[model samples]
Target: MTKKLLKSASRCIAALALTGAAGPTWAVESVKIAGFTWPGYGFWHIAAEKGLAPDLDIQYQTIEDPYESFNLVAAGQLDVVSSTAEFTPVGVERGLPVKLVAFGNLSYGTDKIVAGPGIETAADLAGKEVAVLEGGLAQIYVAMWLEQNGAAYDSVTYRNIIADDAFAAMIGGGVAASEFWEPYGTNTLKALEGASVLAQSKDPYWLQSGVIADGHYMSDALINDRRDVALLTMKAMYDAIAWWKQNPDEGNRIIAGGMSMSLADVELVIGKNGTGLDGGLYVYDFMEAAQFCGSAPGNPPFDQKNGQINDHWNLVSGWWVKFNLIEAAAPPETGIDCSLHKELYDSGYRG
Candidate 1:
């Protein structure tokens, strides 16, 4: 389930915390986190492998859906979560008390719209059905792309299929075309015959220059109350990213094993995304990372330097409120706490 409604994430987080198995040690309160099977979350895989978290023990569980992840972190069952852009706003709106610590990756050319043999153009999809993980970021992007191309969202019959599930159905002719997030999108393109690129998040026509797909997030309570841990984790994350750059093949292998995909397929997915295991800005220089993930004018989804929310994030929040995606009574921007990332970035810790 791309955005499949599941109840296991938080439950798992709570269970892990209670078990206190974040690591083999207990001095600093090891952090337990649940991430999905994407390139971005593999940072933990890299970190844990390198023993970067000597004082910290972070247990990593790769959940497949974002919906479950938000509630898990919000419930304090999990210390951190890496979520997509749409889900974060939903979390905030529902008053889950989540915070946007840093973006996992801005969707460059990663997320894609692939069409099976018969379809050639977006216009050809006017009367045809297209598969998209219902209520997911892919659905939103596909709908928006159709709208931008002089068509209504209703132009195509939208299917409520997850990326992997959609791949199966697409092979069976359940839908002529579909849009899905990366790795899956890349996988679909390779599995299907004669598939053509209908669109990708990296396309310039995409709103926000395709910086709309936020790949990760965390909990505000944890960030505010247990900040020392957050900084240590961030530093470990940076180290992991650096290690990933020097070891893409190994990192991809580990990620592939975790995600249940073939090593070759994982390579393709990472290649498509352009970053793979070390899949982020890297903040190669800690001095710059503070600014990149900080509350400065350059900070994403908000202009901390300019005293405004990152335009991209604010746009998503406003869109949710305008479209009523959250509960009818929910405030779109209510749950997000950007200052958490800002504070973390500014508090003397470089990475």
Candidate 2:
């Protein structure tokens, strides 16, 4: 079925289920969520398809531009957004009514900085144009990599382009290097004769930095007026993750079908195996994520300290300030709401 038809059918099913047509009638809270077309954000579809949160109606929509998603949430049109983890600081700085409530997943080796032949290091791209989605995580990744490798962040010119355009630019020799996620990075190396991956998110430094990650964000209206619904929505996400881990193939199919992506492409980023694959993403389960948010009692996995969410926020905020995307770094509490995670843990919920 077409995406429009699928969404229509989902709404119809939700309505029928809520009206007691198939079973008992109960209060069903409807949540409107928006995100770009990325596999990490596709789990909500799984939650809805598997009836993970039968009490909540999840209406997931694909909005290619994340800034627009944030704007919609801020305007009370959207209740939740699954997007890059770096944007909450910008939202808080701009006074947007949104808070990141969960650290969803980290890019293992999915995100890469690929460079053309002879550009062996970050310094080689100095004064040359590098394609990136301006003000997005790609730009931040490239800038951070550059600064870490003895090159100044401002030394290179950033060409504002989407991933598809950036791929074409890389293949057409239009840019020296560009940051890409998943299949783009893989495809670039295969299609371009001499392209090389200079850095990947799974590298020791990037992994420890927790820079290239995805998260769940919700509007203040939902948190303030519909707190229970917000908590259930968060629970549904991790429930989806747990379900996916137990049933990888079927779960991947659900995500692939929901996102209108090829099964191979979905596997390329999220992996077909139940474990965290070498070139795929690292999905955080409920407890690990809670610890990362400092809501649980233990340290997070991957050598990351407990309550690393604050450090992650500060790191991204500092970069945003350097990028001139924000005037100054906002306090972590202004952008992150960890109470939901804390509530889940304190209630002895573990997944």
TM-score of 2: 0.92
Per-prediction TM-score to the true structure, in the order listed: 0.76, 0.92
lDDT tens string, model 1, 1-351?
Answer: 734435577666676778685633347567877876666566687787778888888788878777787778767788888766566666655678776665555555667788888787778888888887665677777777777777887788888787678888878788888886656676777888888888875555552343445544667767778877877776777677666666777777776776666776555445523343233222122333344444543433222233222444555655555456864433423544545446655665544
Point out the worst 10-residue segment of candidate 2 by lDDT. Answer: 271-280
lDDT of 2 by residue, 1-351 (tens): 699999999997888878774664677999999988888888899999999999999999999999999989878899999998989989987889999999989899999999998899987998999998888889989988888899999999999976788899999999999999878999999999988999998888888778899999999999989999988998999899999998989999999999999999989889887676633798999998999999998887778989999999999889888888999997999999999999989888897
Show the colliding residue pairs in model 1: 10-72, 83-216, 92-335, 296-305, 297-305, 301-310, 302-309, 302-310
TM-score, structure 1 vs. true:
0.76
Clashes of each: 8, 0
Candidate 2 local Cα displacement, residue 151, angstroms = 0.9
Candidate 1 regions exceeding 4 Å error are: 1-26, 190-194, 205-208, 257-260, 272-309, 321-323, 327-333, 340-350
